[model samples]
Target chain A: MPKPNNQDANSLLVLGGTSAVALAYARLRASEGKPIILVGRNSDKLKLNQADLAARTKKPVDIHVCDLSDTAILDKNWNAVTSMGHNISEVFLAYGLLGDQLKTQKDSQKFLASLNTNFVSAAMWAEKAFDHFAYKGSGQITVIGSVAGDRGRQSNYHYGTAKGALEIFCDGMAHRAARFKGAKINILLVKPGFIDTPMTDHLDKGGLLWASPEKIAKITLKAVFRGKRKIYAPWFWRFILLLIRMTPRFAFHKTGL
Target chain B: MKPVLSWGRINDKYCNVVRADYFADPNLLTIAESSDNGMLLAHGMGRSYGDSGLNKGGVIFQTTRQNHILDFDTQTGIIKARAGITLEEILRVSVPQGWFLPVTPGTKYVTLGGAVANDVHGKNHHKVGSLGAHIMRLSLTRSDRKTVICSPRTQKKLFNMTIGGLGLTGFINWVEFKLKPIESSYLETENIPYTSLDEFFSLSEESAKWPYTVAWIDCFAPKSKQGRGIFTRAKFSNYGALDIHRDDHIATWPFVTPALFLNRFSITAFNFLYRWRPGARMKGRSHYDSFFYPLDGINHWNRLYGKAGFFQHQSLIPLERSKEGIGDLLDIIKESKQGSFLAVLKLHGPEYSPGTMSFCRPGKGVSLALDFANKGQKTRQLLERLDACVLKHNGRTYPAKDGRMSAQTFQTAFPQWTKLEAMRDPKFSSSFWRRVSQTTS
Candidate 1:
C-alpha cells in the first residue's frame, strides 16, 4: 500500500527471506517484474533465495544479513536496506522463533531468548518499517502472527505469549495509522493455523486442516493488496480461533487445547 | 506420524518422515548420519508408482521444501536447479522463455531428483532419449557425509550409477540439465485411428519421422480388433504464442472412489467411449500441458482407483520381438478380464540413457504401459504373469512403475544391479531395492 502519488514505488522488502511463506510471497510478487529485497540472518540460505528469485523472474534481487538476536546492528542493517536506492513500498515481517515449549518451561534463558527473537526483535523491526512507511505517508506492513496467539495453551504458552504480544503491537500500529492525518499507511496481521512449513516439520501434518505455505502466501498477498487490517489465512482459522476464544475456563481446561 | 506411501498406494512404509531444507543447519547428509532410524532415503514428490521412493521402518527425508531454481541461461537453454523442484515449477518459469524439457514424463509433477533417479522417458524417446541423456551434472552426497559433484566427463561411473539409482546411491542435492528450445507452447498434432496389432506397428514405423509419437490402445476391444487404438504424432508448432499454462481450473478428486467403481464394466465402457470420442480422430493444435499431461487437469486422479490404489506396469521390449511380446501381454491381460483404463504404447529409439542400470535398452524398442486397479491377490498374480512374459521376450519391467516383480526376474533382467549396489550409500536403502535384491538389511 503506497500513496496514490507513489504508485511507481513497487519494490517489496521481505524481512525473513529464508522463510518458506516469505519466499513464496516474494515469488508471487516477483512475477510482477518488481525488485525484491531480502533481510535474514543466514547468508548462505539468503543467497540461495536470491539466486532462485533472480533466475526465475529475471528481476533484481538483493539480500542483507541481519541476525534478530543481535540488537546492536538492527539500526545499521535497516539503514543499509533503506539506502539501497530502491523504492520499497511494502514490508513483509515473517521471521519468528517457534522454540520448544517444554524446554522453555524449565530453562529461563531459553524462554527469554525465544521472547527476544519472536517479540522483542520482531516488534522492533516492524516498528522501524512502520516509522518509515508513516514518513512516506503511505505503505503496507504485513506481520505474520500465529493462530496460537489467540489464547495461551499448556502446549506452547511461551510461544503464544510472544505472538500474542506481536498481535497487540499490530493492533496499536493500526490505531496509530488511522490517527495520523493525511497518511494512508496500513498494518495487516496474518494469523496462519497449521501451516506445513519447515518450522513445523516435527508435527504430523497429515490432517486435512494443514495448509501449504504457498496457499497461505497467496492469501496473504491478496489481503495486503486489498488493504485488509487483519485476516486468518485459509479463512477457516478465523472461526476455529473464535470458538477457542469463547470456550469457558472449566471446559477449556478439560479439553486442553 | 502419517504413513508414507508411493503413488501406487500399495506399499505403505512406516517411516519417520523428516522434512529436509537447503537452509537446514546440519544439512541433509549430516542429519541422516546422526539419525538412528537404521537406514535413510530421500523422497521427492513421491511420484514413483511403487516402493522405489520408500524406506520401510527407516527415516525418509522429504525434500519438497528444497525446491529452488538456482540458475537459468536463456541463450544456451541450460538450467540448474535443486533436486526437489518439480517439472511443473520449472516449466512455469522456462516455457515463456521458449525452452522446454528435452524429455518429460507423462505427468509434470515428478521432481528433478526423481526424474534422474528413475531416468524417466517421454514420448520423444525416439528423438531425445530420456531425461538422463540431457543431464549435464549432479550434486550427490554419499553416506560418508561427503558431497561429490559428478558429470559424464568426471566421476563417470558414479554419475552413471547415480542416474536410475533409485535414491540408494545417496541424497541428490541438485541437478543441471540441458533443455530443448521451442518456438511456441503448442504442438501441431495428428491423430489416426488404426485397427489390429500389425496396423499399430506399421503406424509407429510410419510416424517415426515425427518427433513425438504414441498410441492409446483399447485393451478391451472386441476379439477381432484386439489391439486397435488411436495413433498420435506431433511436433512443436513453428508459429504460436509462447504462453505458459495456468492451472486455474484444476479439479481435485474429492475422495477415494470406492474400489467397486473401477471394475470391469465401468472401465470397459470408459475405454470404449474414450477411443471413439469426437476428438479422438482429429488433427489439431494442443497446448504442451494438454499434450503432455492430460491427467494433470484433475488433481489427485489416483483417488479414482480407490483406497486400494492402482499399479502401473511399463514394459520395454526389443523392436525385433515387440509385436509378439506386446500381443502376448495384452492377450494375457484381456483373458484375465482386468481392464486398464490407460493403455499407452510408444517406440524408443536406438539412443540409450547414460546410466548403467537404465531400463531402456540401447537398441530400438517398443514400450507398453498399462494401469491396473489394485485387486489384492488377483492383481498381484496378473502382474507376475506379465513379468514372466517380459522375461521370455528378453524385456524388462520399469522399476519406477513396479510394485512386485520377483527378485529372480529383476536380478536377471538387470544384472548390472550389483554395480549400483556396490556404490550404494551404506545408510540409504529403499523398499524396492530390498525386495528386488532380496537383502534383509
Candidate 2:
C-alpha cells in the first residue's frame, strides 16, 4: 500500500496500546483531543493507561481487553473496535513478546508462546483489520517490527524469527490491498532499535543508541502522518541496519554478532 | 539521555526517569531499595534552585505529562488540578476569570506540586502567607502503594508534613486550592528608592496595608550606598474586568550563556542600569507577568550563570534582631565581594504557618541569590562564612534554596527537624537529606 495523505482522519485504534511506545503515540494523538480506542489483554495496564490518557486528553478514551493470541478473541475485538465508530483512521499494531531468549531456546512451550504472540496473533489482527479497513477503503495500519528481525541476533533469535515472519505477512497485506480500488490502505512497518521500556528493564541502559519510548513515538508519529511505508525509528537505524544487512555470512560468523 | 539539572542549572544528576502519565505506580520499576540515593523523587519542571529536587543516580518520576486542570469553580474561585499542573497553566485558565493564585514565587514555570513542596511565598506573603495557606486538599500516594487524601482538618499532622515535605512524604496526585479573586490581571504598582536597610524596614512596615510588597537590593553598591535599591508595591487595579492580555511566549534564551559572560563586572553593570531603569520612580500599570515573574521572560535564565551552577541563599531573621543580623550579613557579602544581583528583602507577617517545617516565619527575610560560577573551594568557603554570620544572629536559611548548608545550620534553623525525620518515609530519602543529616553523627 502506498502512503496515505489523510493524516487528519479522526480516530485511532491501538492494539497492545499499553506498551510504552504505543502509549506515548496514543498520548500524542489524545493531546490533540482526538478519540482513541485502546485494545490489549492486561486489564490492569489498560486501566492504568486509560486513567493516564483520560487525565491528559479532553476526549473520553475507550479501552477493550482481548487476548490477541486467541484468534476468536481477536475477531471479536476487531468487531468491537470497528463498532466503536472512530472510523479508525489508523490501526496501530503493537502486540508481541520478547520472551526470555535462553528459556525459549530450552523450553518448547516458551518458544511456541513467543511465536504465537509475535507472529500468529499479529497475522490474525492484520487479516481482520485489513478486511474491514479495505472494505471502507481509507485507513492506515502500523505494525511495530524490530531491528532484531533484520538479521537474527543470537541472544534474541526466537523473537526475531517471529518478527521476520510478521514482516513478510505485512508485505503480502500491502500487495493485496493494491488490487482493491479506492482502498488507500497505507501499511507502515516501523522498525525500532534498542528502546528503553519495561521490556528492556533487565538491560543496563544508558547511551546514545538506546532511544526512549518518547523519542521512538515521536519518530513513529512523524512517519505515519507523513505516510511513509517503512521507517527505522530514530532515522539513524536505517544506516545501522544497512551495515548489518550487508555483512557477509563468513565475516559475520567471524565477528560473533 | 543526558543528565537533568535543576533550575539553578547546578547539581545535575542522572537517574532512571519515568513518566507518570496520570498516575503510574512508583513501585512498578524495580528501583534499588534505598541504595545511597535510591529513593524516587517526583520532578516537576526542574525548578528548585538546588539539590532538594535532584536524585543523584536514582529514579526521577517525571510528572509533566499528568498536567490537567480537572475542575474549576468560577463563583467560589476554587480549582482542582493534578500536581503536575504548572502555575503558568493555572494563570492561563484563572487569570481571565478575575482570579489568581493566592501565593506565587518569582517564576510561574514551576509546578503546583513544586510550589506546594517548597511552600513558596510571594510578595503578598505578608498578607496571604505561602502557597500552602491556600491549599484546601491534596491526594498523596505512599511508597507502600497506599493512596491517602489529607487536608488541614483530616490527617492533620500528615497534611502539614507533606506541605513543605520536599516530596519525601509521598507522590502528590492532585491539589485543590482557593484562588484569590482579582479585579483584573493588571496591577497598579509603585516603585520607590530606599537608601538604607532601616529605610527599607520602615517602607515595608508602612506598606503592610498594600496587598503586595518586595524590595530588591543593589548588592553591588558600595557600603556608603549599601542596602540602597528599589521597592515595588502593587495591588490589582480595581477595574473589575476579567480581561487580561495573553501573548504567546515567542523569545527564549535558546542556549546557556557561557560562565565568563556573567562576571562581577557584568552583573554589577546590569544592577546599576536596573536600579535606574526608565520610570523607576513612576507609578506604573503593569501586567502580572512583569510584576510577578520578570525572569520568566528569559527561558533557562539560570543558565546565564554557566555550567558550574549558582546558589540562592534566603535567610529569615527574627523581626527584633533583623537589622543587626541583616547588617552583619550584608557586611560579610561586601567584605567578600561575592554579591548576587538578585537580592530581595521582604517582611513576613507573624501568622504562624501550620506546615511544620515551612520556611516562611514571622520575621524579616533577606535573600542573597547570586550566581557564583561554583569555583569549589572558594565558593564553599564564602557560603560557609555567610552561614556563620546568619547563625550568629539566630537566622535560618531556606532548604529549598540550599545546596551546601551544614546540618548544623538546618538543625538550628528548624529545631523541628526531628519531627520531620520521624515522619519521613523509610522508602524515600534525598541527596540533601543525606548530606545535612549525615553531619549529625
Candidate 3:
C-alpha cells in the first residue's frame, strides 16, 4: 500500500478523466482542495464532472475534451494545463477501453482499435508522463492494470493482452527510473479486480467480491502515497489472483475463470 | 431494474433505477411520469435508515451521477452544486479550506438533496438548526415538468414545504448554500459522565454555551445507574495548528453476524462495554470525523444487526418533558431487554427550522435511537410500544428513520404534512408515504 505524503499534491493531470476510477480519484483530490485538469471525450460529462470537481475541491478544475482515439498529443494537453500555471506534480494515466474479444477476433480493425486505445496510445501517453517525470527528477504515476491481465481468459483475451503488456511496461519503467540515480519518480502497477464501474455495468454483479469505484480510488491513492509498485486492490484480490496463477494450465482451461 | 435497500438494510424494494447526469436528460421527467405503478422519486446515496427514499414497483431516478458542483465563491463561502453530491464530498473540500456544513447529521454519506428533503438535525440543533437552515436556493422540477427555484425570499410556501418535504414536491435539481467558517478540522472536547437523567440535564445546561453537545446513554443501565453515560462538548481548534489532512484507518464489516447471536444478552454486554468507555479517558482533542461520524470508520457496521436487517426508532420529545419522557422510554427498553447498542440523547434549543414539516422545534429534546433485530412482527410491536410512549408525551418521530409509524401517529405529530401532501408532485411518492397514508387518507 502507498502512503500519502504531505506532498502538497501540486497539480494532477488525468487522461480519460471521466472513467469511474479517474472520476473517483478526481473527486477524492477535489475534496482535498487540490487543483486538477480532466481530459476526456463527451464534453457534457466533462463539463458536469468539472463542475462537480470544482465544487468538491473549492479549487479550480479545468476540462479539456479530446477523443483519445483521434489525437495523440494529451501530453500537449498536460502542457496546455501546466502553461495555465498549474504544475503537474502527480499524473494518473486512467483512460482505456475494455475490448470485446469476439469483435476483435472478427475484424482486424476492431483488434487494432482496441489495441490502439487500451495499449498503444495509452503507452504513448505513459511515455509522455515518464519523460516529464524523468525531467523533473520527481513525480508519481498510477497506471491502472486489471486482474484480467493476470491470465489469458477466453472471455476477454484482447483486453487482457493489452493490460498484460501495460504491466510489463510498468515493471520496465520501475527499473529504468530506479537506474537513474537522481530520478525520484515512483510508478505503481495497480491491478483492480471486478470494479463496479459504468464501463462494466453490463455485467451481473455479486456480493463482497465487487469493489465500488470510491473504494478502489481510496485504495489506489493510499498505494500511491505508500509508493508501492505493485498491488491487488481491496487487499483480498492478492490471494485470489495468487490462487488463479498457481492453478495448473490444464485445470485452469477447464474451470474457465 | 434492481433491488435496493436503505442504509438500515431493511425495507428492500425493486425498481428500474435510472442514473440522471444533468437536468437536460429528457428521460429525467419522463421516467417519473411513465412509472406504471406507484410513484417515481429521486434516490441519492440511499443513506436513509427506512423506506423514506424507497419506491416499490416504480422508477428510481438516481442522482449520484448528477453530483456536479456548479459554482463556488471562496471569499463568501457560498457554493452552488447539483443535489446529488454528498456531505462527505463537501467536507473533504471545505474542511481543508476552513469551511464546514452549518449543520451536519451523524453520517457524512448523505447527499445534499436527501439532507434537505429529510430536514436532518445534528447535535448542534441548539445552535444551527437542521441541514435546511443553510440552503440559500434550490430548483425542483414538478410533475408538470416546470422547474421552479425556491428560496426564503421567493416561493415561500414551496420553499418551506420542500425544505423537509421528503422529496415529494419534485426532483431537486441543484442547490446553493452557505458553509460555516471553521479554523481547523480538529475539535477541543471534554467528556463528563453523568449517572442519572437529572445529571444529564445539568450537564446539558452547563455546556449550553458550547456549539456542540451530545450524550451517549446506556439504555440498559439499572435503575441506580439510569441515564448514566458521557456528556461531550466540542469547539473547533484554531487554524494555525490545523493538520488540514486526514490520516485515519477505516475498517469494514465484512459479513452479517448471525441473528441468534444478536440477542438481549449480546446487546446488553455491548452496551455495558460501550458505556464503560470514556470514563477512564475523560478529556482530549479529537478529529472532526471521530467527533461527528464515529460509525463511518467502520463501513457497513449495520450488518452487525444481522441478515434480517434493523430499523432505528428515533423519536424526539419536548425539552421540558425530556426527563420524564426519555426516562420512561428507557425504562420500557430495559424491561423489554430488546433494543440497541447506540442510544443517543441531545438537547435541542429554541433554534427553529424554516421547513414547515421540519421535525425539530423549540424543545430540550432527547432522541433515542434503538436498533432492533428484525424478529418480524415482534420488532414492529416493540417499536409501536415505544411510539405509543413518545406520542403520549406530545413528541414526534423522524420519518427518515421510520418504517412502521402508524398513520395517526404521523398525522398527529406533523399536522402540516397534509398541506404539503396537497402540494406534492403527483408523480412522486415513496413506500413510507403510501404506508403511513393508509389510514390517514
Candidate 4:
C-alpha cells in the first residue's frame, strides 16, 4: 500500500459533506492540514459535522449550503467554490437515502424520491466532479455503493436496484476519466454490507456480516490509498455476496434471507 | 435458562467462563443447519484458548448435549460417539479399558471437536505429533451445506485446513481418530530440579529421551537462579505396578485464592519451597489425572490474577538464540519487576504435521508464561518491551496466549496473516482477530 501523501495540505471539495462517511473521511484527511469545502443541504447539520471535523483536525472547515436535489443551486455552489483560489484535489460523493421499501411500494412520490436521491443526484454530482477532474487532469472521486446492489432481495429490491444503477454509472465515469489528459480520476465504488448508521437504525436486526462505521472508514481509507478496484469495505463481503449470487435461483429464493 | 457466571476468568482483557452454559439438556443436539450455509459444527467444552471453537455470534451447532457413546469396539480399542464427546468423558469410559486419548492438553475438559480445532499436542508431541495426525476420518459440512466425509486421501485440502483452520473453512460434525492403549491409569514419574539456566537446558535435553517430559520454571527467580525449575518426566506404569484412583474427581480449590495471595512475597516463598521440598526424587507413582493436569485441581485458577485478567506471553525462540534470547528475556522480566510465578520451558522436537501455521518448529523452545496484574498503562508498556525482545530474537508468540501485542507485532509474528486474511470469510470473525486487525465492527 502507498503511504498517504501530503495532499491534505491542499484544498478539497466534498459534494455531500454532511454525510457521516464523508465527514469522517474529511476529518481524518484534514488532520494533515487539508482545507475542506463541505457542500450540503441543511446548514445546521452541516455546521455540526463541520465542527466535528474542525475539532479533530483543528483546521478550519468551510461549509456551503446547497441542496443536491436542486441542480441550479448545486451548480451555483460548485461554480462559486471553484471560482475561489482553492484547487480541488479530491471530491467525495456520499449522499443517499434508505427510502422505506414498504412506503415506496404504495406511494409513487416515495419511489421517485428514492430513485432520484439514489441515482440521479449521485450521477449529477459525479458528472460535475468528473468534469472538474478531467479539466485539472488529476483528482480522486469516491462514491459509496452498497452490497445490496450485488443482487436484489425481496425485502429491499428497489433500494438495491437504485444502488446497482449508481455503481454502473461510476464504472462508466471511471472509463471516461481515464481518457482525459493529466486527469487521474478513478471512481471507487464502496460496496459495504449492513452498516450500523443513523440511516439504518430503525431497521430490524441486520445480517451477521454487518460492519460498523469506524471499520468501514478504516477499510475505505486503506482501499483508497492502495488504489483498489471495487473495494469491499470489510473484504469478506465480496466472497459472501459472491456465494449468495452464485447460488442456484431455486435454492437462493428458498433461503429466506 | 439464565447463564450463571461460574468459574469466571479473564485472559487478555476478555472474560471467559471455565464452565458456564445456559442449556440443561445434555443429550440435546441443537443443530442450526441452513441449506446455503455449511454443515453445523458443534462446540462442546470450550478449551480452545483461541478462536478455534468460536465465531463471534455465529451458529455453533452445540453438541454438548449429544455426548453419548454410540458404540465401542473394545476388541480393537476403537470407540465411536456423537461429536459432542469430551476427553474427560472419554477418559472416564475408556481409561479403565486400557485406552486413552492419543493426544491431550494440560487440561482434560476439552471436547473432541476442540481437540481437532486446536490439534492439541501433549508432552509426547515429540513422539506422536499433534492430534490431527492421528485422525482417521472426519465428517464435515462444507459451505454448500453438503455432508462430506473427508480423510487424508479424500477432500485432502479441506481435511488439512479444517484440522487447524480455527473452524473458518468449514464445520466438523464428527471425527474418528486412533487412541493410544495404555497399560494402566498410573504413571511412573520423576521430578528433577535444576538451579541454573544451563543445567535446566541440559537436563531437558537429556530427559527428552523419555516418552514424556516437561519443566515448570519460576519466572520471578533472580538472575543468580535464572531458568531454575523442576523437570518432570513420566510414563504409564505396567498393570501390576499401578495404583489406580477411580473416585478422585473432586476438585478442592473451587474459587480463586485472594488477589494478594499470589503477590511477590508469596510467589517467592512458593518457588523457594517448591524447589527445595522435592529435593531428590528419582522415581514415583501417581494417577494419570494428577500427573497430567496438576493445576486442573485448582478450579478458576486464573482468578489468581484477579478481575483485571492476565496475559500469557509464550514465545518459542529458535535453538540458535536460546542462550542469549532466554537470558535477555529473563533479565528484562527481572529488571521490570513483573511477578510471574509460572514459567514453563520445554524442548520442541521437529515439526510433524503438514500444518503450515503450526507454532511448533525444530528447536529448543522456551515458553515464559507470566501473570501480569493488569495494571493499565504500566502493564502494556512492559508487554511492549517484551515484544521487542521476542522480535529481536526472531521468535514468534503463540496466538492462543497472546492478549496484549500490537497489530504490527502480530503481523510480524505471523507473516502469513495476509494469506489468512485472503481466506477469511468476512462474515466469520473473532474478537481476537477483530482486535488484532483493528476491525471494530
lDDT of each: 0.87, 0.78, 0.82, 0.66
Superposed model 2: Cα runs more than 4 Å off: A1-9, A164-183, B1-115, B122-128, B139-147, B170-218, B224-262, B269-309, B317-328, B341-353, B363-368, B391-394, B426-428, B434-441
lDDT of 1 by residue, B47-68 (tens): 8889888877777888888888
Query: Alpha-carbon error at B60 in model 1, in Å?
Result: 1.9
Residue by residue across B117-222, what tens digits does model 4's lDDT show? 6666778776667777778788765443466787889977667666755555555566877678888888888988778789977887777777788788887776
Cα lDDT of candidate 3 equals 0.82
Q: Candidate 1: where is the Cα deviation over 4 Å?
A: A1-9, A103-110, A179-183, B25-37, B439-441
Selected candidate, larger DockQ, 1 vs 3:
1
Q: Write the per-residue lDDT of candidate 1 for residues A101-172, one digit (tens) a residue.
A: 989999999999999888998898889988998888888899999998999999999999999999999999
> Can you list each candidate's DockQ?
0.67, 0.10, 0.46, 0.01
What is candidate 1's CA lDDT for residue A131?
Answer: 90
Find the 10 residues in a row with the least total lDDT in model 4 chain A. A1-10
DockQ: the better of candidates 2 and 3: 3
Where does candidate 2 chain B have its weakest 10-residue lDDT segment? B28-37
**Real contacts retained, model 3:** 0.78
* Residue A48, model 4: Cα distance from true site in angstroms: 63
lDDT of 2 by residue, A185-208 (tens): 888999999997778766777788
Deviation (Å) of B95 in candidate 3: 1.5
- What CAPRI grade goes to candidate 3? acceptable
Task: Look at candidate 1 and tell me the lDDT of residue A63.
Answer: 85
- Residues B346-441, candidate 2: write the lDDT tens digits: 877754456877887544454444445565687788889888877787778888888889988788778887887888766566667777776575
